[model samples]
Target: MSTISAQAALLPTFSEVQKAHRRSDVLILDRHGELIHELRVDKTGRRLEWTKLKDVSPALVKAVLQSEDRRFYEHGGVDWKAVGAALIDRFFGSKTRGASTISMQVAVMVQRGGRPLGHKTFRQKWDQMAAARELEKSWKKDEILEAYLNLVSFRSELQGIAAASRGLFGKEPSGLDLKESCTLAALIRSPNALPAVVGQRAALLAQSLSPGEPGEAYRRTAIDALSRPYRLRPYLALAPQVAKILTAGAGQGELSAQTINSTLDLRLQRFALQSLRQQLDLLQGRHVGNGAVLVVDNATGNILAYVGNSGDSQVDGIVAKRQAGSTLKPFLYGLALEKRLLTTASVLDDTPLHISTERGIYMPHDYDHRPRGPVTVRTALSASLNIPAVRTQLLVGTEPFADRLRRVGFDLRRSAEFYGFSLALGTADVSLKELVNAYRCIARGGIVSPLHLTPGHSGRTLRAMDPKVAYLVSDILSDPGSRSVTFGLDNPLTTRYWTAVKTGTSKDMRDNWCIGFSRRYTVGVWVGNLSGDPMWNVSGVSGAAPVWLEVMNYLHGNVRSAPPPRPRGVVAARVPAGHGEAERGELFLAGTEPPSVPAARPAGEAWHIARIAYPPDGTIIVIDPDIPEPNQRVFFETENEAPGLKWRLNGELLPPGEEGRRWAPRVGRYELALVDNGGKVQDAVSFEVRGQNQ
Candidate 1:
């Protein structure tokens, strides 16, 4: 036996690399199995992935053996014949040809971590031969060949047969033909060789192998093919987020994912991006440099298209937190309805009002700077009147309203006290995803479902609000007539199909947003500068609503947004005339409908009105310490006077004829009671007078 052969038998064999091989790139595939994007580098830092020997093309395998190490199968490990020839050539000072067999190369690649074989000493060659012989005893020839192909470097920063095949030919190893195989084989010896040299060698080899074919006349097919630019879907913006969820899961170990089957449709993504870019192109002069669009399936909560940013902004606006503006009004109104504090037909004063706060006085006004007198809750919400929203928040306390928004999937990230009443005007920051999901809750009958990016992930759905109230809010938003008070009838929000949408512009016009949902899809769009710069005269209707309309029209090309069926516990009632506007049809919770009142009082014997009229029940009367004691007295009044009526303050009897009588206010609770001659209480109310008037 040869001396090199004797030394090779002393090394250990490795059979684990085959079973544990994985790709470094996390490929993202669309619903139709088309490649969308690839996370090119994994956590391990190496792009090495195992490819099975059986899956490799036999033509490429033959080409490699013929080019690198012929008689590979005939020899045990070290090819002594070629080694002796190489040594003799070196001794004679002649150019040396190849000597190491495929097995020897595999040993060096696997053991040395793919160190390039630029120039090696005889000792290194000897050690590689030893490892090769040892590997032969326990591993098959196919296994050794597979390991070598996967470990060998094909070019600069490009390693493994799979990467070479994809990077150079845009194909898999199994798809390589004889000509392509010969080219790949030539690259194995000199990956950095000039194109002409590599092409000549490959063509000559291909001709020698298949004399019948016209390969000698062929041009540099592989080099020419690689020169063409490769275009891929621009979905890198979503990679970091998608990778985190796919890699480390319950049963799946860290980075176990090879590919992510995303719910995004590549075609729709392209269209949505085009729509946003087209709109942004027109606004370039206005310094509008960024925008984002998100579309989700209302039925399944699957995110169909998520464009993080359209104008090359590194920041991902889809999940970026920004001030929510009037987009939050729907939830506020819905909460009011759920608490029975207000209804669709309830009247709200949209006039300017000042609210006292520790910092200073807060006065809210309508966006148009005009008061909408006694607008119904429906008109106020649909018009997105700032004053009415603030007033509504007053009725439904600030802290409770903030908590309701948080429970409905908005990431407030701070206590309600931090935001205060301005939260009604959407001072709170929220991501487009959170806002869309919160709106989706309304579309799904008040059920909040997470937006799923990957397929087969069924998120938990929770009831965030009463379905009936959500339905009423949706009805109000869908009414074009109500919104016409601000947006006009022919605005972009008026879709042919029934869609409930709202437009909001943040303070200083830093952000403009249009978020809405149809029966099947919820689309949210934001148009603004990513740097937080204010826009030039851009409102939500002109900024984001047009893009939203384009996407919605494409989505509903053949379909329509039909109104949802009325759920149980919802009743249709006629709202009395003389309200803000005649309620075409009012929806009310079955038992919460307003009581029927006669248009006129009964004629006769001086009808008496019951209940206290002044210092209305539940009123938090603020005492003015600056005013004189007599001037601060609160006047008490009744709708009508009755015989034998006497007044009692905090259960203490007072003089009769309390009508028009004034009582001094104090910083405490007072229960005012009216009794008849029998001492039976006819009317009573407990009201608190607190806080020294500012």
Candidate 2:
């Protein structure tokens, strides 16, 4: 009796055992508590969350008791009647029968370094019996039964009732019927036995549970239950990428908590996944394999939907860094607008431009390879013109633009000189999450904040850009009439409601992106190959825009997406026709509004400013070796041809004739100047011809 008291004092309490059990997987739940994904973090034996006594099905409890211990409720810890009967059977019968109560099994399971049931020595058996008696005295009957159900190993790598029932039957323990409960209870006795043997034991247990039922019917049901394949079906699994992210460094306490409530909406996540898959299917045979989509709430910056990849690869596309195409143009133009360097109606030359950089000469061209001559900032941005964007990058300075991108969320670790003028064209690599959040900053009126995946988790917000500038950029992006230069009026970018959208295709069509925002949500989509292979003829408008449009339309199905109200410091003004744009109302900064007087000049009288059109400054004209020197002509053309304009080569006057405007190729450095009849230089450019005359 003293030894029993000592053993009981040494045993751990029920709460201690419950707290020590750790599951191998963590359950990620939606905001509404619906399971989204089940991620297995622990690679050891599979153990699910602890199943409470009250949560366990009554049928399962009765079945387990009937199979393991018939007098479970009647015995203190060990049934002396069954033990004595087993002893008598060992002496007289051919086979041996053993009796180990639920309390006894719980004692062995919870004991530190305790031997397994069949392998225990005689001394260990005595100790186990003594511990069982002590455990029954200190813990409740229900506690012992619950611990037994959880700590018992039912099958291979399956430890606990939760794992067994879910792995074998694909349902919760509470949903287990009589036959299913019997089948699971039979696993406790011979976990590694053949399925047919386990099935026979389950049939016997079922027959005992239902006395009047036919024995053969029970046998058939139990056999069918055991014959089916066993697999642990994941619950929901709508957000595998999110689950992987959240459980990256979780501690034991977090993993044991079982359910992590996230800010993801189940409906939106499902729809976004479906939409991305459908778009990738449509782009079949174009070498397009993977894509991702992200949707955020503009008000709170909560990530509503995140699809990492389109089932093509295991890589998470949401965080994968890819070259950002024209998507970064908005922020560049926004900075220019904020600094008052450019306005919506300000004219930007869309013609060829050559700028010297550390790497080499950088030449920017429009998407269609046809320049629109002179266009307003509104038209330049809306049409996604590359030359205008690169020129704007020059005005904003590459360092300042790169700094602006970093302030938002882009992970641009390189120096400004590394990105150079191409930064405006999104030459820097960025992830979908970073890009979407940056756009969300614009949607939130220029205030940048961290996106939250868990509810109630938020970070500080910073004013990345002025609200006025953000509003102006949004207004320009929403105007389809201005975007008609590139995407045309009728396209996927045009939604029924008001949405400011931009599409970008990276160099060599390796990546395509379509990001936009409605009044309530910001949606971003990317389509390309995850292997870094270029897509075949796939553009942003045709590849990613359709998915963006579908998601935007669904989000606004019941809600109206009205245009954002104009903020202060922005005023609309009527501008006279100039720079190839008709007279129209344009938004401008308060002090930068155009003067009321028309700026247009009379035609054919130097109405347009003349700039060297052909052989842009710093051009290296290479003479083809196969062609004769006289046949190779480098034409000198001005932006606006006037009556009195003359061409001067190497400071020498050229005769006024069309043939004189075309100079024969020569291996020498030359400076070409565009001068008026008064010999006043209007525009000049330098070029070097290199090659041996053939």
- Note each model's CA RMSD in angstroms: 20.1, 16.9
lDDT score, candidate 1, position 216? 50
Kindly report which residue pairs in candidate 2 clash with one another.
none
TM-score of 2: 0.77
In the range 478-584, model 2's lDDT, one tens digit per residue, is: 87667877876557887656688999999999999999999899999999999999999998899999999999988998998766776666676667777755555
Instruction: Write down the TM-score for model 1.
Output: 0.70
Worst 10 residues of 1 by lDDT: 598-607
- Cα deviation at 427, candidate 1, in Å, is 0.6
lDDT of 1 by residue, 177-233 (tens): 777788788888887777677778788777767666665533467567445542222
**Which one wins on TM-score?**
2
Q: Tell me, by lDDT, which candidate is best.
A: 2
RMSD of model 1 against the true structure: 20.1
CA lDDT scores, all candidates in order: 0.77, 0.83
Segments of candidate 1 deviating more than 4 angstroms = 1-21, 43-67, 70-80, 90-97, 107-150, 161-254, 597-694
